[model samples]
Every structure is written in C-alpha cells, then in structure tokens.
Target: MRARLTLGFFTITLAAVALVSVAVLPGLQSRLIDAKLADLAELARQYAPELRKAVGTSLPQSELQDLVGRTADLTGSRVSVLLVVTSDGEITVEAGTDSATERDITLDFSVAIEAATSGRVSRGTEAGPNGQVGEVAVPFLFRNPESGRRRVGRVAVFSSPLRDVEASVAVVRDRTLVAGSAASLLALLAGFLVARRLTRRLEAVQAGAGRVAGGDFSARFPVDREDEIGELARTLDNMRRQLAELDSARKRFIATASHELRTPIFSLGGFLELLADEELDPQTRQEFLRHVRAQVDRLSRLAVDLLDLSKLEAGSLELRPESTDVAELARRVAHEFHPALAAHDSHLEVRVPEDVVEVDCDPERVAQVMRILIDNAITHTPSGTDMVVSASRRGDAVRFGVGDFGPGIRRAMLPHIFEPFITSDDAQGSGLGLAIAHELAERMAGELLVESQPGRTTFTLQLPARPTPPRPAAPPVVTEA
Candidate 1:
C-alpha cells in the first residue's frame, strides 16, 4: 500500500509539472517574439527621420543606398526601405557589414504597407530563404507644408526568434525533468527502507507463530520498539507465558488426583482380603471379594494411565530397543490373553508368517501394545466373537494388528479414542490402555493406528525393521571382585 501511494504521488506531481510547463510554453515564446519586434520597431522610428533628411529632395539612388548602408552597419541589421506610387514601387537593400551575406528575396509586403499607412503597426512570423524570422513594419510619415497632406515611407525589420526561445524553454524543461526524476528515485529508496522494516517485524511474528503451533507454549516474541508491531509482540509473549502456566497446572492436577486415589484403593482391597478369611457365609464372602477385586482393578488401571501420561509429558520414558520377531510377539500376546478371551466367551486367532518378520523396537513395549489391542478387542466384542491378531512385513516396517468383529467405535469418537478416560458403552477396560500403548509405541520408534467401521475395528502397530547382531552371553561370574 505504501509503495502504491508513493507511486501515485509521483505520478500526480509529474503530471502537474507537465501540464504547467505545456500551458506556459507557447505564451512565453510569443512574448519573447513580441519583445524583439517592439525593440526593432523603436530602432526604426529613431532612424526614419535621419534617413528622410539624408534623401532630401530626390537624392541620387547611389547616395540613398550609402545612407542605408551606414544605418544597417550601426544597427547590425539587414535593413530594407521601399517607396511606392499607385502604379509601381522601388526597393533598396542596406546590408550589414558584420552580418552574413545578404540574399535578395520576394515577400508580400502589401499587407504590411497598408497596415503602416492606416496608423497601425503590423508584425508576423514568416519563412525566409535562410529560416523562419520575425518581421515588423512601421510607417514613416512627414507633412507636406504647401499641400498639408501626408507623405509616407515604410521601414520593415526581420530577425530570427527560434534560437532564443528554444534556448530559454530548454533550460526550464531540463530542470523540471531532472527534479522529477530525482524525486522519483528518493521515493523508491524510502519505500524500500519502509518495506524492509515492516517485513522484519512480520517475519519475527511468523516465526513466533510457527513455534506456538509446534506446541512450544513458552515461545515468545521480542519487544524492541513501542510501535503497534511491538505491542503485538508483547501481547503474544504474555499469552505464551499464561499458556505455559495453565499447562503446568493441568498436569499437576492429573498427577495429584491419580496419586490420591491409589492409597484408599489399596487399603480397601487389603481389608477385603482379611474379611474374606473371617468367619462368614460363603455367599457374603464371595460378594465382598468380588467387589474388592473390582476396586483393585480400577485403581490399578488409573495408576497405570497416570504414570504413562506423566512419562510421556516429561519425556523420560526410556525404551530398551532391540530387533525381535514381530510376528512371534503378536502370537505370544494373544496366547497370554487366551484366558481372558475364554472368560468373555471370545476366541483368539493368531495369523502370522512362519518366517520371522523382524523389527527394531522395545520388545516389552511392542508386546505391551499387542496386549492392549488384544484385550481391547476381547472387551469390546460380543461373546463368542473371533479376535484376530496378525503381523506381517510391510516394506521397511513390520505391522502388527488386532481386529475384532463387533459394534465398532462411532466416527465422532474416533478422533479422541486414544485420549485418557475416553470410552464407549461397549468398552470395559480402563480408557488409558490405548493411550498408554500409543505413547509406549512411539517411544519405541513405532506408531499405533486405529481403523473402524460399523461391524469391524482394527488397531495396527508399525515399527521399522533392521538386522541386529546377536547379544553375547555373559561370562560365568568369578568370586574375585
């Protein structure tokens, strides 16, 4: 916008200059021509009386020419004098000694002579053999004493006006053009400096925004100036600090709630175990025992989820990476969940290649992911449903999946499925199971993905594969330190 405004200013200034120059040029040229004509007319008026006295009483033609020559030399002009009757006219040339060679030329002087005789001055520009010249004619009148009538002779003057007018206008035009050009250049330099300053602030804002988007709540902008941009930067910095404080408060709340819940739950389970052994009817003991077990399970799940969230947030979850057979890992987790599957009337099916599909991952964390997936499938699916656990090599990675035929997760809930405490009506396990599994998988340099439709759901875990050297067995321990 600034650049455009500057350009507009320059355009208007230049146009105004051009218009004024154009408007004044023709008038100035005319005035210059008229002034030269007036000077020549005045010189003619002064010389006319002297010339008439020199050509007194019908003087010889040679003597009249000599007087004309003397007048031309004194005035530095090419002069001409004419006398005419009703039927004929005579002309004599008075050439200047210092001027260029004189050329005899024909001109229509009848109009000029008529104007001079009518007591009016006549002046005009006319083309000559050499170039354009300014011409002026004035009448020389004397009284006839006996008849008391007027006798008249005409003196005409011509001079070049083009060179003088051109020289004067050229100077003005050149000055105007130079000033306009310099102004334009200054405007461009100013625009560049302003653009650079504005872009610098904008770039800093852009970088701060990028950091904020990347989850850096502590990211801030520099406050170096007191302009609007500086105010904006300070506001952003304050917002970042506030966000960091809020985030810290939220994490602290979660940690405190998880820790406080653990103690009472452990006590309740311990007292319930003692009560189970006391003298009581079988039915009451069994009911109390079942409730205690449920409470224990709930507390265990909450504790696990809180721990996993804390580890993920703090960036302190250590991964013991190793290359292991991913297919075997999936099968092993399925086997471990066999009892739970059976209890739910669900059947576990393992699908894997006979050859090992190796991957680089934390074996324990990968197995934990498989356990979470299989358990989730068993808990969500209807009784007697088949839970399939499968693993395969997919390009540079190995993929392990646990799928179930059940009333799958709704589309709206899919986005938040891995969030802690998120659950559907069909979900029986702690919601943190999936969340913990996802965090652990990522720590092991792998990923966990979920896909579900109306009647099917699959959780897939993928990890990179590379050959790893076998670990050497530890040497037998010696008694010596």
Candidate 2:
C-alpha cells in the first residue's frame, strides 16, 4: 500500500511538471523572438530618415559606414546583424564590430523585395546563414508632400540570431528537472508517512477482528482520528463490546437451559422406575404414571417455548393483528389460569374494566402473553399469594398487567427478565416463560414491561389502541331546498 501511494503521488507530480513544460515552452520562445524583432524595427526607424534624404542616389561609402556604425551603437544589441540593401536586393551597406572586413552576407532576397515594394515594416523569423534568426525589414519611402504619395527607393533589413532565447530555454529545462525531482521526492516521503499511518490503524482493526474470531471479545481497536479510519475504529470497538455481552448471555443461557431440561428428564426417569416396581399396587403405579405424564408435559412445553424463541430470533414469528378488547383477553386468561392457581394454593383476582378498550393485536398471541404472565405470577410466588389480572387504557395504548402480592424479583434480574434462560437465583421454573411472552407481545405489535418492588411485582403488556373511525355525514333533506 505504501509503495502504491508513493508511486501515485510521484506520478501525478511528474505529470503536472510535464504538462506545464509542454504548454509554456513554445509561448516563451515566441515572446522572446517578438521582443528581438521589435528592437530591430526600432533600429531601422532611426536610420531610415538619413537614408531617405539620400534617396534617388547612392550615398558616399564613408557616410554610409558612419550612419550604420551609429545605428548599431544606439540599438545596443550585442549579437545583432544589420544591413542596408537597395530595392533590387543588393547589400549596399553592412555594420558590425568587424566593420573593417568586406560585406558579404545577403538578406532573404524575397523579404527584401516585399519591404521595398510595399513600403512598410515587416517582422519574421527566418533561417539565417549563422542559425535561426529574428529579423525585420523597413521600406525607405519617399513621400510626395503635395499629393500625399509614397515611393520606396530602398529597404533596411535588421537580423538577430536566436541563440539567447535557446540558451534561456535550456536553463529553464535544467531548473524544471531539478524542481520536479525535489517535488517527487517530497511527495514520496509524505505519501509513505500517510500510508503507514493508515495501515497501522487498519492493522489494529485486523488484529482485533482476529481476536474476536478466536473468542476473545475483550479486544478493541484504538484509533483516534477524525477520518474514515477513526469511524471504523469506533465501530470495531462497539462491535467488540456487543460481542462480549452476547457471549456472556449465550454462556449463561446454555447453563440455565441444560439445568432446566435435565431436572424434568431426571424426574421422569425416576417416575418410570417406580412404576416398574413388581410389588407396586395399581394405585401406586397409576400415581407414578401421572407424575411421569406431568414431567412429559413439562418437557413438551419447554420444547415449544424453545421453538418459539428460535423463531423470534430468526425474525419469522407470524401474527394476525386485529382490533380486539384488551380487557376481555385479560379476563379470559385469568379465568383459564384459575385451576392452576387453585392447584398452587394461590388466589386469582380480575380487575379489568369492560369499557370497550380496543387494541390492535393478535388475540391468540395476546392471550398467550397473558397466560405466560399469569403462570409466572402464580408459580414464582408463594402458595396462597393473591394475583391480580388487570387491564386499563392510558393515552394511545391499552395495558394488561399481571400483579402478584409476593416477594418481588431481584433488582439484578429485572433488566434481563425478558432475555431467554435468564432467571433469579430463587427461580424454579424453566426460566423461558417471560422471554417467550416478550417475543409474542412484540410480534403482535405490543411491548412487555415489568415493575417490581418488595411484596408487589407487576408485568404489563402495552398494545397500541386502534384508531376510531369517523361516522358518515347525514344525507341532505330534499324538502329543505
């Protein structure tokens, strides 16, 4: 990753440098050439007037040499080539530091013809005998004062070699190479540091995941940035905590479920052994058989509870919700549990008001929830304890509650009451009734909540009320019209 990141940064930097060089080099060269041509044109302006006074005739050789020498001195171009040519493209006068040498260089023959005929200054780059050069030509015009007419009698051509511009460009190329190298080095160093920082954080997360996979839920990622890496670290830490909690829950659940199932199975085995005794009377055998049947029923109910809890966990618990009176459901479940209350030597009380309190819930599921709450209230409390089954309307919900006048559940166990196989130390049942009840209530679009105090414990199922539909408007009377 670090290698890739560094390479990416370096590649981008070099690409930018290349693009700037390609875009700016030609324009730079052209501007420098234009500047040289402008200087030559200005020099021609200076010498044209003197040449114009000598029009229609050739100047004396000494005077032409002096004029060309003074023009070269004023232009101040160190590497300039100046020439004075006749309209027929003959070089009449030439000036340089080597004025002692004989003149031999020729102007571009076509350019000289154009200037002398057109009577205007023209600038261009041309291939000179020395190298490429920027040159300008100015037509020496003889304008008629009265008729406002002009005639070209001569042309002055000035040329400068392009070595200065090329040398400047070479220097720029060297500097660009040096700067691009420095920039690429800097980008590589920065990219390596950034990638290392990122990968270090990711490695922490990877190690944490491995630990969790190995059943060590305590591992956590610790990155404190404000970027995506930090968000991932926080998410991993949260997942670790949740996994730890779920791990604890699963361990406790397995232990509790095994204990619950084993006790009933062991009891059934003992009852069968007693029934198999050869000298046992018919009454004794029948009693033992009844005990075995009771244990079998316990096992059956536990199995059903397990299946329902699994379905709830899998998010496939089905329900058929309808508008039904919550009060009626509570009363029916209370009456149905009266026999069980009698068997346990407990009393049942119904406190539901039949005021048409309606809720959107599955009637059968709601009844199952009520039965679970009532059974818990009766079985968990002492014999002869009075249990009340009640229903009431509060705002937008109808609440059915089962209350017992017995020792309440421990505070530590209250929060986990709806969790499967979670129970108090004093709990004797399968420890699955409330979990199943909670699931059924939720599947029916209701919530199960519990409140417990010393000597009073109440579990309530709160279901949303069905909205009352508005009545239809009365028909208008025709006689009124």
Candidate 3:
C-alpha cells in the first residue's frame, strides 16, 4: 500500500511538470524567435539606405561588405547580413565577415526567393547550426529623375544566429527537469509517511481482531487520538469486554443448570427404585409414590424453566398486546390468589385508583408476572405475610406492584435474584419464576424492578400507559346447522 501511494504521488507530480513543460517550452522558443525577428527588421531598415547608395553608385563591394560585418559583430548581437544580386535568372551571395562560422550557412531561401522574384519584404525563421535563425529580406531600390523609380540590381537579407536565445531556452528546460525530479522524490517520501500513519492504526485493529478470534477478549488498542481510527479502537475494546462478560455468565449458567437438573433426577430415580419393593406396606408405598411425584413435578418445572429461558435467549417469545386495563388485571391476579393466600394463611390486599390505568401490553404476560410476585410473597415469607397488589400511573407509564412485609432478601442475593436457579434455601419453588416474569415483562415492552428493605419488599412492573378508548363491540355471530 505504501509503495502504491508513493508511486501515485510521483506519477501525479511528474505528469504536472511534463504538462507545463509541453505548454511553455514551445511558446518560449517562438517568442524568442519573434523578438529576434523584430530586432532584425529594425536593423535592416537602419542600413538599407547606406547599402543602396553603395550599390547604385557602383562603388567597391568591400565598403558594403565591411559595414555588414561590423553590424553582425556588434558587442551583444550575433547577426549575419547577406547581400544578393539577381539578374537574368542568376544569383550571387555574400555574407558578413565576423558571423560567418557561428550559424549554419545552408538556410532555406523560399521567402528570400519570393522577395527577389517579386520585390516584396519577407520575414520568417530557418534552421542553423547554433539553433534557429530569425531572418528578414527587404528589396533595394533607387530613383533617377529621368527614369523615375526602378528596382535595383541587388537584395539584402538580414539574419541572426539565435545562439543566445537557444541557450536561454536550454537553461529553462534544465531547471524544469531538475525541479520535477526533486518534487517527485519529495512527494514519494511524503506519500510513504502518510500511508504509514494511516495504516499503523488499522494494523493495530487487525491484530486485536486476530486475538479476539483466537478466544482472547482481553486485547486492546490505544485510543489517544480523537480520530476515526481511535473511535474504532475504542469500539473494539468495548465489544471485547462485553464478550468476556457474556462468556463468564454463560459458564456460570451451565454449571448451575447442570446441578439443578441433576439433583431432582437422582431423587426421582431413588424413589422409583424403592417403589418396586414387594415388602413395602401400602402407606409407605403411597408415601414413596408421593415423594416420587414431587421429584417429577420438580423436574417438570425445571424443564419448563429451561424452555422459557431458551425462548427468551433466542428472542423467539411472541407477545399478543392490547390496550388493556392493568389496574383491573392486578385486581384479577389478587382475586385468583385468594385461595393460595388462604392456604398459606397469608393476607392479600388489592388497591388501584378509581380511574382506569390503561397500558398497551400482553395482558396474560403481565398477569403471569403479577402472579409470580404474589406467590413469592405468599410462600417465601412467613405465614400471614400481607401481600399487596396495587396499580397506579406515573408519567406515561403504569406501575403494577406486588409487595409484602417480610424479612428482606440478603444484599448478596438481591442482585442475582432475577437470575435463574436462585431460590430461598432452594425451597418453596424452582428459582426461575422471577427470571421468567422479568423476561415476560420485557417481551411485553415493560420493565420489572424490585426494591427491598427490612419488612418491605416491592416488585413493580412498569408498563407504558395508553389513553383509554372505548372497547370495540364483538361482531354478532349467526348459527346454522
């Protein structure tokens, strides 16, 4: 990844440099040639009259040649001037002395050919040894009063070697190449650093995940930076902790369930073995059968508890909800418990407000929860324990309570009371009632909470209240045989 990133940076940087060089290099060469051509044009204008005088008077050619040589050798200029004479389809060429060897001598003459053939001023560039030369050709003419104006027997072409302009362009090209190389190297370094920084955190997360996959949930990553990577590390750590806790809970549940299930099965086996005794009396046999029945009942309760627990854990429990009156529901549970309360010699009270406490919940599930709490209060406490069934509204929720004045649960057991297989001295009933009630309350979108102190223990099921609506009338049914 780092290598890929560095390559990407280098490619982009070099591409930009190449593009700029493509655009600037040609324009630089063209502009230099244009400026040089402008200089040559002015020079041709300045010397045109002198050369014309020397030509028309038929003076020595050395005089014109010397002037051209001096102009070509000027301190900072590398210009070469040529004088041509064309007549009867024949041509003669002469160059300035000092600039002869500086540029290529074989320059194309298409523009100069047109000028000599048609007597027109021409300008263009041509290749030379030192580089490209910018050239201009102007016709030479003279006037005689007797014959008016007529073309002279000569043409002068102004030329420059262009060595200095070529040198300047070379310097620019070299600098661009150096800058581009340096920038590409620097970009590669920067890209590697960036890729390393980003991938380091990801690597840590990967390692942590591997450890978790290997059944080690204690692995953690640093979360110092307030970045996305840091947040990811924190999230992974939280998941590990939750998983560790779940694993511990799972182990404890397995051990407890095994012990609870094994005890009753053993007892039932022992009693069934004894029932096959031929020497046993009718009363003793009946008593042994009763003990076996009790063990069977215990096993049945355990099976039911395990089934309910599995359903809750797998999230398969379904609830049928209605806008039901929880106050009336509490009253019904209290009335149903009257017989059991009487059997246990316990006192029961049902209290609710005159107004309906309507809540959207599965009424059977809520009733089941209330019954469990009432039964616990009746059986787990001493006889004559006053168990109160009450319902009232608070905020947008309704609270249904079954509380009793009894010795409170031990603080150590209070926290785990809602866990399965926890009962008072493993007596009165299987320890799954409260846990089942809690899960049922949850399935109905309610919360089951217990608060206890000496002489007072309250289990409250809080459910969301719904505004009371008139109950729908049942449709009439027609009977036909």
Best by TM-score: 2
* Sort order, lDDT high to low: 3, 2, 1
Worst 10 residues of 1 by lDDT: 472-481
Task: Give candidate 3 misplaced runs (Cα > 4 Å).
Answer: 1-75, 78-127, 133-207, 218-230, 276-287, 343-345, 376-384, 406-431, 450-456, 469-481
* lDDT assessment of candidate 3: 0.76
Can you tell me which runs of candidate 1 are displaced by over 4 Å? 1-290, 467-481
* Per-model TM-score on C-alpha atoms: 0.48, 0.80, 0.68
Which residue ranges in model 2 land beyond 4 Å of their true spot? 31-61, 78-121, 129-132, 136-139, 144-148, 151-153, 189-197, 214-218, 281-287, 343-353, 384-386, 392-396, 470-481
lDDT for position 471 in model 2: 40
**Local error of candidate 2 at 462, Å?**
3.0
Compare candidates 2 and 3 on TM-score and give the better one.
Answer: 2
Candidate 1: RMSD over Cα atoms?
16.6
TM-score-based ranking, best first?
2, 3, 1
How many pairs of residues collide in each model? 0, 0, 1
Residue-by-residue lDDT tens digits, candidate 1, 394-417 = 567788888888988989999878
Candidate 1 residue 75 C-alpha distance from true site, Å = 15
| Per-residue alpha-carbon lDDT of candidate 3 for residues 98-167, written as tens digits (9 for 90 to 100) | 3455545577544566566677777887786556777777666656578786754456667767888889
Q: Is candidate 2 or candidate 3 better by lDDT?
A: 3
Residue 464, candidate 1: C-alpha displacement in angstroms = 2.2
Model 1 backbone overlap count:
0
